[model samples]
Target: MDLIQRLDSRDADFASQLSRLLAFEAEQDESIDRAAADILADVRRRGNAALIEYTNRFDRMTAASIDDLEIPRADWHAALAALPTAQRNALEAAAERVRIYHERQRSETWTYTEADGTMLGQQITPLDRVGLYVPGGKAAYPSSVLMNAIPAKVAGVAELIMVTPTPDGTRNPIVLAAAAIAGVDRVFAVGGAQAVGALAYGTETLAAVDKIVGPGNAYVAAAKRRVFGTVGIDMIAGPSEILIICDGKTPADWIAMDLFSQAEHDELAQSILLCPDAGFLEDVRAAIERLLPTMPRADILRVSLANRGALILVRDLQEACDIANHIAPEHLEISTEAPEVWAARIRHAGAIFMGRFSSEALGDYCAGPNHVLPTSRTARFSSPLGVYDFQKRSSLIQVSQAGAQTLGRIAAELAYGEGLQAHAASAEFRLDKP
Candidate 1:
């Protein structure tokens, strides 16, 4: 009964209770931030020397220079070839699907001429270079490599540089294989805030990147926060979250396991279920109790479910949609008879898994959609990582003399209204210039 918070929409304090359960203010540990700041500063000041020093001290490497950390192109190809047949095939399959999906998102340079001969349009161009940070050591996730790198390549990025820590000189072959499959241009065996700093501010050998992507530990997040202006970065991600709206038709066991998918992510991750049927809620509770002990990360699941997870009794599917919009969770699964009907009613969520068959886990790996999504209720305004994130847009303006006469007058009027006579003169000069 105490596994997770239980709430009823009929209760007077239900809204307040749900708010408290959903609230998650990630710890801004000043110490970690300060440490990250110091590392970034050192790397920016000393370049390759600082990068090698941190790589040696933190990852236990004895590299003499930058060349020692740069993984050769042939090594990436070797890793790809060395992968077991099934693993290699799966990585390629995932990469191909991601590429296909993101290729549709690539924007092109477009322009249209007006009647007055003013050509206006948006020109889309890929970044010159980008940095991808992959978590190394025991947290190697080859899937993440596909999710981050494939989109950049699909966006026509010229160069994709990947930096992953090799703790104790142990490189994750799977990650390397993924990078090769994703068409990454380069690989470096370095990580941490130092890697981020080196990417943002070029080292002696490594050129600076225009943008950086991929997920990492707390230090990586802090480093991204510090280097936002110097280089474009993906969002500062928060703890994962999953919310399921079941109409009691789906099996309770299915719903229970669905909740466990995100809960297993970490102790801070959250999972919640909204159902109109009280009996089904209890059935899911029993299923959670039965399945929790069997999980390898049962301890983490217990802490996560106990602290942030919830089972709420909503008035109906309509009310469930309303509550879901309020929560704006990272992942939403509409497990019901007609998920589309309810999905249409919903307005906010990072990714929606419709029907009983569409699980959130599938979306995380190979659902043809980018898994790097907005979190911490950021779905309200932000979006998942895609080719668009790797591309930038510039406005095209070619005004003919006649067209300029009109546009210039408008601009000059506004500029003069804001109080500058020079602006008015500029427009007046162009008004009748032969």
Candidate 2:
């Protein structure tokens, strides 16, 4: 079998082939959904008792009470202090960069008054509390902690609560240290649907959060979806995807590694390249063959690349840009001579890495943008998580008497047209009688 799929825009069946490649229908597993719903209901009904039962059974914990799952603030600081100098420095640096970037996104309340003394504005306020879920099973992503929590703190969230599964009672210290660095108010070792339930429906020990933001596995994702109405949730991200638009001027090795970055994430993750040069495409193909063996995640890279990755030859840079708009990928790398020229044409993407040197990996770490991006073509409408997600806006209005005279008439007329007598009467009540 070929190491990875290859296609040409000139092919007659190319459109259908590209559609097939992009198709990633997340199967709604009824069984999983039911299980999650049951767990949520249990948590909602029994509260702390059910929380302890599920945590103990699923994560192999022996907690006598919900209090047992709470990680002390002292432990968070101690985790920070205990980190090796290099890791600690990198974590702090990444946190600071993320904080600085998110601060720029903080929404502020603004008001404007008309000549008639009518005032209208939007009032921005932070969420009272937020829940951050960090996946703690396969790998410890301290970076997830930093990305999810720092933005909430930057938005002036009053309290930040974190939940991560500590399977077999094993907690990842780095994640704890990140909690300390990110100013997380509380850390709970409970995870899975139970943790999400606890966050959405407040328990005796853990209060319900205004919103929950983070990534998780199948059950956790299903749980997030189930509890969305009870508590706001971040996007249910699909497999990570990266689309690179190369003018075939960048190094083949660089392009290959960039593709590998997302592919190595998992077997479902996707990476693709769009270039005009056939010769350069071959060079990148050769580069992928040469470098795949050296990666620690070569097996995952191999499977993901073979299954979902693609290399396409476009007619020109403009064509590549057009195709990128069609895909609306989560991560876009415009690795051409004048990247901005093509990036300007892009209508949609979660994040655009301009120039060859700006690898997607950098953005995942200290690059000052949230790596939690909209995946699976969701970039067409949604956006990356930021301070904006942690805060809400309320429309402010204070109508002057003269303004009400006009607005009330309009409102009553429309209300009466709709046959809502109460609404019409309410509006008419504010008007001066003839």
Candidate 3:
């Protein structure tokens, strides 16, 4: 089977073909939207009762009340203690790295005094509460728990509540351990759109949060989109993506496996390689065929590769970088002699893995960078999840009498130009008689 599509930069239709390949419209699923709307409304109307009913119906649990679903602080600590020594150490180490990295991103309040004794600056403050939704059941992601919760904690969020669905009364200890390590204030065994609603609208038992973060299924995504205005949410993520620009110096097998790392995420996920060396592209193709069968998720990897993966023969490294900026992929790896040299040319990418040895997987786990990144060309305007996402800024202004007189005329003129008589008068009233 020809597992990957091959393209050339010289082709007349290359730009259009690449655009078609990159196009992914998350058109609203009417059914999912209707279901989410109903659930959100129900949660808003019924609060705790609705949460309990949905929890039992969807998660296959028999909890009578919201309290029954809550996992206490002691259990979180116990889950952390119960982990194997190696797992515990790795989780702790990853948490520490994530914390240290985000600490540098913390914004501080600053002010400057004008010559007229006017004060203007900005003040930074963390969100009072936040909600993190972790996908539960077989898709347990302890790494996500660390990624979402640690930043909120680092930003000094007063309360961080997490909710995950435990189908059939099953719980994932690793996820719990991550929550514990990340200093989550509370945990509940609830998920799906209903959980999103509960977080946004607040159940009788659960306090409404200022923002909700983390990834989930389609239903959850739709729910987040629906509740965005009522509460803040992280980006509506699309499929995982990885774009590699190889100068053809790296080992073929290494490049092949790097492509597979993102392809295995799901069938819709995209993995593309841009190389100037046609021979090296062929070598990587052979390596992919050799190594793919050995992957545990070979079926998924195969479909993903066959459907969305590509090997494009670019004219040179500069052309590859140009194409990469156009795609603005979620994860970009530069496998070259001086990765930094090419990386500086990249204008848009969620995260850049510099050098041949730096794998995208490191950023996913313990590389000290947030793995939750903008997807689907959103890197053009969006950024990775960090402390800034959990923090808010307020503009500060203290106008002295003399400063107000000087500023009022400018404000009045702008308001008058817009035909806002009330605004013009309000500004004019603050002006001193000349």
User: Candidate 3: lDDT of 128?
Assistant: 98
**Candidate 2 Cα lDDT to native:** 0.94
Write one digit per residue (lDDT tens) for candidate 2, span 1-434: 67999999999999999999999999879999999999999999999999999999999989998889999999989999999999999999999999999989998999999987899999999999999999986579999999999999999999999999999999899999999999999999889999999999999988899999999989999999989988999989999999999988999999999999999999999999999999999999999999999999999999999999999999999999899999999999999898888888999999999997999999999999999999999889999999999999999999998888999999999999999999988888989778
Q: What residue runs in model 1 are displaced by over 4 Å at the alpha carbon?
A: none
| Model 3, global lDDT | 0.94
Candidate 3 lDDT by residue in tens digits, 217-241 = 9999999999999999998999999
Off by over 4 Å in 3: none
Q: How accurate locally is residue 33 in candidate 1, as Cα lDDT from 0 to 100?
A: 99
> TM-score of every model?
0.98, 0.98, 0.98
Enumerate residue pairs that collide in model 3: none
* lDDT, model 1: 0.92
Residue 229 of model 3 has an lDDT of 90
